[model samples]
Target chain A: MTPLLDIAELAKRFEVGNKRLLYAVDEVTFAIGRGETVGLVGESGCGKSTLVRLINRLLDPTSGSIRLAGTELADMRARAFAGNANRARIQMVFQDAGDSLNPRYTAADAIADPIRRLKKMSGASLKSRVEALADMTGLPRELLSRFPHQLSGGQKARVGIARAIAVEPELLILDEPTAALDVSVQVVILKLLQQLKRELGMSYLFVSHDLNVVRLLCDRVLVMYLGKIVESGPAAELFADPRHPYTRALISAIPQADPDKRVGRLRLSGEPRSPIDPDPTVCRFYGRCPRGEPRCSAEMPVLRTVASARQAACHFA
Target chain B: MTAVPALAVEDLSVEFRTRSGTVKVLDHVGFSVDKGETVALVGESGSGKSVTAFAVMGILDPAGRVTSGRALFGGADLLALSEHDLAEQRGRELSMIFQNPRTALNPIRKVGQQIADVLVRHGGATRPDAPRAAVEMLKRVRIPDPERRVEAYPFELSGGMCQRIMIAIALACRPALLIADEPTTGLDVTTQAVIMDLIGELAHESGMATIFITHDLALAAEYCDRIVVMHAGHIVEAAPARELFAHPRHPYSAKLLAATPGETVSLAELASIPGGLPDLRRPDLPACRYSDRCERRLDDCARPLPHRVIGERHTVSCWNPL
Candidate 1:
């Protein structure tokens, strides 16, 4: 079966003050099937944002290929891609769109912007479609006229989601969608997104730092470290027994409410190895890995198959 | 804890004179922190958790007034102290860590100088001696290259490093009580764990009472010994950490616990708390704030909020608690 979205050897880099090159995203590859939810989990400076931007075409990739339904996305000019025919096929919902939503625009107007720009629908149809999107996102029609200041956090989040899905995108890129919401409200939004995925048959690339939320929502998970895809596996399988050492530390750090379960400290200390002008010879997790050996510094470990449906970039795995 | 609590608040009511009207931000909010104990103030935004902390710290906003309450710290009512006396007591016996360390830290000043300022003012270090003492505090918080990082501005450091500086400044004088208001809100999960570990270690070493104000129930469960659930300026429930998570008595708490993402059976089991927070400005607000959102609300809930003691340390303000 053809994947809804596919990428190969994707990389993005930036020059820092003419002295060093920052590998915002190193060589990485992944895919998402139709209606599948794949989570991207990583810490700060791990290139999670860079990967999402590359896939969504918000930022141009330095090299490699991105195929959505077999159409090449990387070759188009950056400005041209914005107005490309395939522009409406992929959409993004950013974190804290509460602040991102234009203060001058009402909730309805915010949701209608994408529809007008992408779909070219106006007048009565646009108004009706805006209300429909609001309804689909669990936003009340009555609150449509309220400006951003007048709307609650959850309501603003709904407007953001409603806007992103207004054009009926096949794949939705959610960058920490529920990161700014309270737990109670977060659950509601997560459920809403899940239901919408099912109803609309849309694929999702859910990027978040919260592993528990990822475990609950994602079908598969991709773990990144210092601009590289360190591990990938089915969500339940990966979370239950993470193969990579970094994955283990990330999982151990989650603060669980269950008191009967006590987490042993797999504390990751010190900053991650510099992404700027990284040594191609050494493993990214070398300095911080608790299980680090002499061999780790001598060679960079590639993502080797660890299980039937899992892979991890670790020598032991 | 042998005689007087490290800090105690009673029947605290606070109001803000907003343009609309007097907003009752906190009502009958009370909690106590024993020596070396960590209490978590957990609730949604606008739940008055932060307001309770601000009221106790005697740092209420200009428009805000503490109408009725007694904040007893070291047997002295903090509410009754003059501004001068309150200022004197603030950093010496009581200190707080705000949510965003970047914004809280002075942008123009060197991070080292900021910590030194706290040391000189509260820790009784002389001006000439404060910088070295500040570096020692930084080392205690486990910052790498403390000497070099001390002179670095807050912006030069990463989010985690800035948070460490904030922790160092807050703990400079080893205050008896520490109020951390969403200290790790904007940090990554890994960094959040590290920061919490630092706070946990420092609090244990110094035997300081801590009131951790946050919206994350899971984080509170992991760090705090006691959990205080607030809603619309009222203490809905307070209980031992394990007991509360094992079996929450209040409807709001059960919903909050279920709503939190964990190794849950399924997302369908999760439920959002229905309805919005009661308008504090409204005179006709319900006595039980959760009643508007509670599925199991009873007529008795309308009379007046009833405080019930379930276990030795468990308390609830619901008429028909689960």
Candidate 2:
């Protein structure tokens, strides 16, 4: 069976001053299987947001193909793609629920706007559909008349989820949906996402900096650094024994809640190299890598099979 | 254990006179940090962790007043100090690292000048020599090429770099106590680990008492010597870091631990705490604020809460503990 989304050699570049091009996403290739949850983990400036925008058709990619269910989405201009039929097939739940929501729009109006625009429902049907969505997302119906300011953080998050799923998309892109919420509320929101996926039969591309949450929810995980994917594998195996040095450092940096489980961290030294006009021949993890070698600067390592279904972009892996 | 604590806050109660009503932000809240010890105040938003720190730092908004409290530090009652006296003691004996470094930092000034300004005012540095001291401070925080980066503005630096500058400014005078309120909230995990390690190392070397306020239970467990769990306006539990995680007596602490996602826990196994924080402005707030949401509440919980000494250093305020 064909995957829900297949991205091949997708790249986006912005021209900084002095004609220097900042390669935001560099030759990234990945796929999301049907009903699969794929997590994208990376530090800031690692191009995760750019990749999300490219796939969601908010930003046009400079190169490569984004095929959704065998339909090419990269060819259409982002402005024209708004009116395309595939727009409804892919939806995104933004990071901050409160900031993403317009304060003037009530929860009901926020949910109904998407449905009325995409599904083209009217008056009574729109109200009922909004009510059904509120019910589905476990948002209180009575609170739908209230504005974003009147709602709690969790309630705002529920409305955000409700709005994203109003048109019944096939693939949901959640960009740090729980980052702004409390831990208790985050658990509920995550579980709701899981249940909604199971019921709706949709694929999820979970983007977050929280590795623990990513490991809990994702089947496969991608670790990106400095505009390139350094590793990709099953979440459990990758986290347990990460192949890439960058991945290992990232996994070790997470502060475990259990004091007994605290281990000496693998610290990354120095800042990330400049993204503007980066050396195409050298590996991205060269200078800060704990096990840096001369060969790392001499050549770049492409993703290759390290295990049965695991891939790592390292010469030593 | 009999030695005077670096900072001791006793019976701290604060209220904010807002347009709606007077909101009790902190009710008889008290905690202390020993010399060279790191104590974390952990809680969700509106849990009064930051407010407690602000009360101790004398940085609360004008409308917010401390009704009753005695913050004893360095043979002085900080709460009763005059404004001029408190200002003198602020950066020299007490320092704070605010949550957002980007906003806390002066956008128009060079990062080096900001650090220099703190040193000149609090560290007794001369105006001419302050820049050199500022560069040394930057190097101490492990910022690469401090000489060149000193002239860069906050906007020119990344989030992690800006945080390092904030740390440099906070520790310039080597204050006796440091109140870091969610210092790593917006930073990446790797950056957070680095920043935390830096703070821990510096505190250990200088024997500076630290009150680290954060909502991340795991981070508190990893870095702090003791953990104080707060809910609404009260400190529900206080214990050694490892002891609290292993044997949490308070229902709120247990629920918060169970709610946090960990390496081994699955999504289905995670428990979400029911109900939100109670309205602080309510006139008839219960003596035990968590009793309404707690599953182990008893008739005794309606009365004044008891701070019980359950173990060596563990204190819980619940009437009925797990």
Candidate 3:
């Protein structure tokens, strides 16, 4: 079966001064199966956001193909993509629900805006649909009339999720949806997302820095570093036995709630190498890798299959 | 255990006046940090974690006023101290690392100069020799190529780098007590580990008392020796880190732990604590702030909460506990 979303050789570059090129998203490739929740994990400046923007068509990619359900989307200009019929098929729930929502817009209005724009429904139908969406997302009906500021963090998050799914998008892109919320609220939101995916049969591209959350929610995981995907595999297998050094560092860095579970951590020493005009021949994790050797700096390792349904970009995996 | 604590806060009550009304931010809060010990003030936002830290630092907003309490540090009352005395003790004997390092740092000043300013002001270093000491501090924080990076501005560095610079400034004077408020909230997990390791090592070496305020219980469990769980301006539970995780006596603490994602728990098993924090400004608030959302609440919850001693070092303020 064809995947819900297939991305190949996706790259986005920014032109810094002095004829320098910042490779924000460099030759990334991944796919999401229908109803599958794929997690994208990486640190800051790892091009995770840039890759999300490219797939969402909010920003034009420098090169590569983004095929949604076998339909080419990269060829369409980002500006024109807004009016395209496929616009409603892909939706994004932003990181900060409070900031993403318009302050003046009431919760009801926020959820209705997307449905009205995309579905072209109005009057009683739109009102009932908004109410239904609220009910589906477990948002209290009375709170729908309240503005963003009047609602709590978890309420605002519910509104954001309701708005994104109002159009019944085939794929939902969640960019750190629970980063700003408390753990108690985060669990509710994560459960809601999972339920929504099951009910609607929608695919999810869950991008988050919280490895614990990713491990719980994602079916497959992609570990990106400095714009390149260093590892990709089944979530359980990858986290249990990460092949790439970067993935290993990220997993071990997660602070375990159980103090007894604490072990000696694998610390990444130096900062990430400069992204601007980086040498293509050198590995991105070379300087910071705990197991770095001369072979790592001399040759860039291409991501290759190492085990059953596991891939790692390293000289020795 | 008998030695005078590095910092002892007794019944610290703070109130903030807002357009709505007077908000009781901290209600008779009390905790103690021993010398060379780390205690985490763990809670969700608006749980008075930062407010407690701000009150101790004497940097509470002008609108906020300390209604009652005594913060004893080295046999001196920090609350009763004058502004001048507080200022003198702030950078010299007490220091804080703010949440956002980019804003905490001087934007226009070079990173090295900022570190130097702290050293010269509190470390008694001459202006001419302060720069050299600042570079050494940067190197100690593990900033590679400290000589070149010292001249760089805050904006020129990454979030982690700026945070290291902030740590350098905070530890330059080797203050007896340090308050780090969500120092690694926005940082990556890898950077968070490194930064936390750096702070832990430095504090261990200096025998400094650390008050770490963060909402992440997991992080608190990993780094802190004790965990103080706060809710609606009240400390519901305080216990040793392992004991708190292994057996949370308070309902709120148990709920919080259940909510936190872990290696073994699946998404379906994670139980979110229902309801939001009660409004602090309400005049008819319940004696137990968590009673409204608590499943084990009883009629007795309407009365004053009792501080139940479970273990030698564990305490819970609750009418009905787990």
Candidate 4:
């Protein structure tokens, strides 16, 4: 069966001063099946956010194709894409509800704005649909009258989710949805997303730097570093046995609650190499990798199968 | 371990006078930190974690006031001190590392000058020694090329570097207590690990008592010697780090643990605490703020709350505590 979303050889580049070009996201390729939740994990400046923006068409990719339901959208003009019926089929829930939501808009108005703009619903029918969505997200009916400033963090997040789902999209992209919330509140939001996915049969592209959160929610995981995907695998398998040096370092860096279990940690040294006109032959993890060898600069390793259900872009792995 | 705590707060309360009404952000909140110890203040937003820090640091907003409390630091009543005394005591006796390093540091000022300002103002360094002392402080915080970087502005440095500058400023005077409010909130996890390690190492070298305020349970569990769980302005539970996770007594505390994404639980299995924190401005609130959300509510919960002593150091403020 064809995947619900298929991305092929996606790349985005920006020209900096001195005529140097920077590859923010190098050639990447991945696919998401219907009702599947694929997690993209990386540190800051690893191109995770850029990758998402490219997929969502918030920013156009420099090259490559973004196929949604076998429809190519990479090269489409912004205006033409907006009018496409497929626009409502893809929706995004931004990272922080507080930051993403406009302070001037009330909770009810925020949710209704998207539905009316995209679907052009109005009058009493729009009001009823907005109320139904509020009920679905477990938001208090009375809160529909409140502004963004009056709601709690969880309530604001509910409004964000409610607004995103009001159009009944086929795919939802969540960008660190719970990073701004406390653990207790984060749990409820995660559970709500899980239930919604089950009920609506919508696929998810969850982006986060947190390993623990990805472990709980994602079916598969993709680990990126320095604008490249270094590893991809089943979430459980990757957590159990991280083959890539970067993934190993990331997993070890997580501070375990059980102090006894936290042994020596592999602190990756040095900052990421400059992305501007990087050497094509050099591995991205060369300098910072503890297992770096002289051969690392000779040729860049590509992602290859290391286990039955896992792949790592490391020569040794 | 020391028999007595280095900093102790009892019956602490704070309120903010807003247009709507006086919002009681904190009520009867209390905790302590031993010298050379790390204590985490964990709670959601408006749960009074940061407000408690601000109150202790004498930095509460103009509209907010410490209504009642005793914060005893070296037998000094921090709450009752005058603004003049608090000013003198701030960086010398106690200091804080504010969250969001990007905005905390002055954008146009040289990083070195900023650090030097703290030394001259609080460390009593002579004019000639202040610059050298600032450079040395930067080196201590592990900033590379300290001399050149010191001349750069806050905008030139990375998030981690700016945070190191903040730490350099906070520790330049070697205060007895350090209050860090979400110090590593926005930085990458790896950077967070390094920043936390640096703070822990410095506190150990100076034997500085630390009050780490954050909402991330895993991070708090990783570093804190003790953990205090707050909800709706009240400290619902306090216990040793291990004991708190192993056997949480307060229903809120247990729910917080259950909510955390750990090695044991999948995201789907993690349960969020039901309902939201009670509105502090409400004229009528339950004796126990969590009573409405808690699944284990009891008949006695409606009455005045009770502090149940479960162990030597563990305490729970619920009538139906686990």
Candidate 5:
């Protein structure tokens, strides 16, 4: 079966000053099937943002191919891609709806702007479509006249979701959609997203640092270290039996409410290596990883599979 | 076999004078953190968790005021102290680590100077020794290449590094009590664990008490020795970590446990606490703030609530507790 999105040998690098070249993302590859939800989990500066930007064509990849619905996107020009109808069918919802939504724009206008830009929506038809999207997302009709600042965090999140689905997109990239919300409200938003995905048959590229939320939402998970994909597999399988040492450390760090069931505490020692001018010979997780070996410093390990759809980059694995 | 509490708060009622009217944010709220103990003040947003911290720290905004309360810290009423006395107490006897490390640390100042400032003010270090002590603190918090990082600005460091710098500054004086208000909210789960471990270890070493304020019940359960669950400006439950999870007496506490996602169960079993916190400004507020949303609310819930002891080191404030 053809995948909805596929990435191969993706790498992105940026030059900082005259002396250093920052490797923002390095040799990452993954695919998302239709209606599948894949979570990209990592700490800050792990290149998850760079990978998403590369896939979305917001930033040009240094070298790689991003096939969205079978079309290679790396070769396209910015304006050409923006004008492409397929671009409208793939949308993104960013972190913090309050920050992303324009304070001056009302809920209706915020949702309508994307539709008007992409679908050429206008007049009464545009108004009706905006209301329909709001209704679908369970947003109150009374909130249409309120600005972003006037709405609550959950309501603002709904406005953001309503806007993303206004075009009936086949793919949605949600970047920590529930990170800023309260836990109770977070549950409601997650349920809404899950329902929408089922109803619309859309694939999701979910990005977050919260492992529990990722576990709850994604079918598969990708673990990233300093600008590299350290591990990837089915969420349940990888979490239950993490092949990579770094993945195991991450899983163990999650604090469970039940104090009786204490997981062994593993604090990752030392800081992560700098992204700029990284040593090509050294592994990304070498210095901080608890299980690092002497050979880890000499050769960079490649992603090797331990089971079906499960890959981890480690000498021990 | 418990020593006297380092800080004991009683009938601590705080209100904010709003343009609309006087909003009773905290009503007769009280808790205590014994010496060398870790107490987690857990609650949702707008549940007066951070407000209580700010009130204790004497950092409440101008719009807010403590109407009535007694906060006895080190045998002196913190509420009765003048602004000057409270200023002297800060950074020496009491200190706090805020939520966002990026914003908490001074952007223009070098990380070393920030830590040194605390050392000079509270640790009584000479100017010459301040820099070295600052680097030592940095190393203590497990930041790599402490000497180099000391000279670097906050922006130059990663989020986790910035957080460590914040922790270094907070622990520089080794205060008797430390208030960490959502210290790891913005950090990754891995980094959060590391930071919490560092704080816990240092606090234990110094025999210092800590009041950890967070919305994540799972995190609090892991790090805290005793858990104090707050709801709508009131402490709903206080229990030992193991006992609270095993047999949660408060309805809110039970709901919170069920809401937290775990490795053992599917998402379908997770249940969220329904409804928002009651507006404090409303005139028609219930005597029990959680009564409106609680599933097991009784007729007596409308009356003034009192703490009911269930077991050793366990107390809950609910008329119809689970």
Candidate 6:
């Protein structure tokens, strides 16, 4: 069966000073099945956010294709895609709800903006739809008239989610939706997203650096570093036993809630190599990988099937 | 545990005078830290976690006033000291690591010079020796190529590196007390782990009493020896980390633990707290700040809350605890 969203060999590059090119996203390939949640986990500057932006058409890809339901979206430019017919098919809930929301707009108006732009609906119908969306997201309908400043963090997050789902999109891209919230509020938002995905039957692309949250929310997880997908596998299985060395290190870095289960962490000492004009032949995790071998630097490790339903970009794995 | 706690605070109340009325920011907030002990003050945004740190550090804003309280540091009272006396102790005897290093640091100055300023200002280092000492401090924080990175400005470094510099400056004087307010809030998990490791290491070497302020209970449970849970400017519970998580006494503490995104439970099973914190400015504020939203709240909760000692180190301020 065709995937809900399929991206192959997608790349986005930026030219830095001195004519050096920075590969923000390079040769990335992934697919999200209908009603599936795919997690993108990476360290800072690992190109996870760039991949999501490219999918959302917030950034245009320099190469490769993005197909939604087998429909080509890469040809459409970022600005042009806004008015394109597929605009409502893909929506993004930004990371910081407080800052992403317009302070001047009320909660009702914030949700209504997407519907207005995509559906071009106004008047009593629009108002009722906004209230309905709020209700679906477990937001108090009475607070819809209040501005963003008046809402609590969880309420603001609900407003953000309500806005993204206003158009009833098939694919939802959440960029660390609960990163700004407290633990008490984060679980609520996470639970709400899970329920929404089940009820709406929409595929989800969750971009976050938090492995624990991804473990709870995602069906499959992808680990990226320096513009490449290093590992991909079933969420629980992958975390239980990571194939790639980078994935192992990333997983070990998560502080376990249980003190007795203290992990003998796989510490990666040096910072990741510069992405600017990176050597195409060298593995991205070579310098930092504890089990680094000469073969890692001589040739890039491509993603190869490793287990029953998993892949890792490591020659040794 | 010792002759005296590294720092002891008692009946610390704070208020901010606003245009409309005086807002009570803290209501008799109190906690203690032992020398070489790490205690985390965990709470939501308006829980006054940072305010407690600011009050103890004597750095409250002009609009804010310490209505009542006593903060005993070593032998001296931190609240009784004048501004000038407090300044002497800030960088030397006690220091703080702010939330965002990018904003907390001086953007214009080179990262090395910033560290040198702290060392020379209050530490025993002389003006000429401060720069070299600063480089050594950077190396201690495990920043690679200290010599080259020393001259790099704050803007030239990444968020994690800037945070390392912040840690370096805070630990420069080998302070007796360290206050880290959300030190790893915006950082990546790996970087957060590294930064936390560095803080733990430095605190041990210097025997500094650390008050880690964060909203992340998982992190607090992992790193801190003791946990102090706050709500609406009041400390709801305080206990050893393992004891608190294993069996939370206060209703709010239990709710907070349930709300944490641990993999042990399904997403739907995880629950959120029922309601928001009570308005501090309300004329009829309840004595128990968490009573308004607590499921275990009883009529007795409306009366003045009393501290109930459950265990050796565990205490809860509630009429009906879990």
Which sections of candidate 4 miss by over 4 Å? none
User: With candidate 6 superimposed using the best TM-score fit, by how many Å does residue A163's alpha carbon deviate from the native?
Assistant: 1.5
Residue-pair clashes per candidate, as listed?
0, 0, 0, 1, 0, 0
What DockQ, between 0 and 1, does each candidate earn? 0.80, 0.85, 0.86, 0.71, 0.68, 0.75
Residue-by-residue lDDT tens digits, candidate 6, B1-322: 4434899999999999898888899999888999999999998899999999999998899899999989999799999999999999999988899999999999899999999999889898898999899889989999999999999999999999999999999999999999999999889888898899889988888789999999888899989999999999889899999899889999999999888877567777788888787778888898998877877778898789899899978999998887
> Which runs of model 5 end up more than 4 angstroms from their true locations?
none
Which portions of model 3 show Cα errors greater than 4 Å? B1-3
Better of 2 and 3 by DockQ: 3
lDDT of 1: 0.91
lDDT tens readout by residue for model 5, A1-317: 77999898999999899968899998788899999999999888899998887777788888988888898888876557777877776788989999999988999999999889899979999999999988999898989999998998899999999999998888899999999987778888888899999999999999998788899999999999988899999999998889998898888889876655565756788778889999988999988888778899999999989789899999888
lDDT tens digits by residue: candidate 1, A237-299:
998898998998899889977756664658888878888999998999998898889999999
Error (Å) of candidate 6 at residue A210 is 2.0
lDDT tens digits, residues B104-156, model 1? 99999999999999989888999999989988998999998899999999999
DockQ for model 2?
Answer: 0.85
lDDT by residue (A10-97, candidate 2, tens digit) is 9999989899999999989999999999999999999999999999999999999999999999999999988888999999999999
lDDT (Cα, tens digit) per residue for candidate 5, span B42-69: 8888888898989898999999899889
Per-residue C-alpha lDDT of model 2 across residues B1-322, encoded as one tens digit per residue: 6655999999999999999999999999988899999999999999999999998989999999999989999999999999999999998889999999999999999999999999999999999999999999999999999999999999999999999999999999999999999999989999999999999999999999999999999999999999999999999999999999889999999999999988798999999999889999999999999988989989999989898999987999998998
Show the lowest summed lDDT stretch of 10 residues, model 3 chain A: A256-265
TM-score of decoy 5: 0.97
Clashing pairs in 6: none
Residue-pair clashes, model 3: 0
- Order of quality (DockQ): 3, 2, 1, 6, 4, 5
